[model samples]
Target: MPLAGPVALLAVPLGLVAFRGCSTCWVIGPTQTISSGRLERTCANGVCTLMKAGAAASPAATP
Candidate 1:
C-alpha cells in the first residue's frame, strides 16, 4: 500500500487554494531600467512598492 497516492490527491486541491490566495494579494508589473539598475513594480492591497534589481539579483550576498 503506497500512501503517496492518497496524500497527493488531497494535497493538490489545497495547493491550488493556497496559490490563488497569494495571487489575489499582490500583483507585479514589468521591470524598468534606471541609471542605477533595474526596478520592479509591485502592487499589494492597492499600494505599490518598488524593488531594486541589483538587490534582488544577488540576495544571498546581502546582509
Candidate 2:
C-alpha cells in the first residue's frame, strides 16, 4: 500500500511532463483541405501548399 502511494506520486509528475512535451510537438489548428479537378490543396501548421495529380486523365495545370 505504501509503495503504491509513492509510485503514483512519481508517475504523475513524469506523466504530466511527458504530456506537456507532446502537446507542443503536435501541429495544432489552421488545417484545411480543398479539392479541385486536378489539384488538391492542404493547409497545415500555418502553411498552405499545392499537390498535383499525375494521372494522365487529370486536368491540366492552370495559371
Each model's TM-score, in the order given? 0.29, 0.28
Best candidate, lDDT-wise? 2
Q: Model 1, residue 11: what's the lDDT?
A: 99
Question: What lDDT score goes with residue 14 in model 2?
Answer: 79
Task: Flag regions of model 2 displaced more than 4 Å.
Answer: 21-63
List per-prediction Cα lDDT, in the order shown. Answer: 0.60, 0.61
- Tell me model 1's lDDT, rounded to 2 decimals: 0.60
lDDT of 1 by residue, 1-63 (tens): 599999999997788788775543343322112233566676666978778754543333456
Q: Count steric clashes of candidate 2.
A: 0
Show how many residue pairs clash in every candidate, following the order shown: 0, 0
What are the RMSD figures for all models against the true structure? 13.9, 11.2
Candidate 1, residue 13: the lDDT equals 79
Model 1: per-residue Cα lDDT at residue 23:
46
Q: C-alpha displacement of 60 in model 1, angstroms?
A: 59
Candidate 2 lDDT score relative to the true structure: 0.61
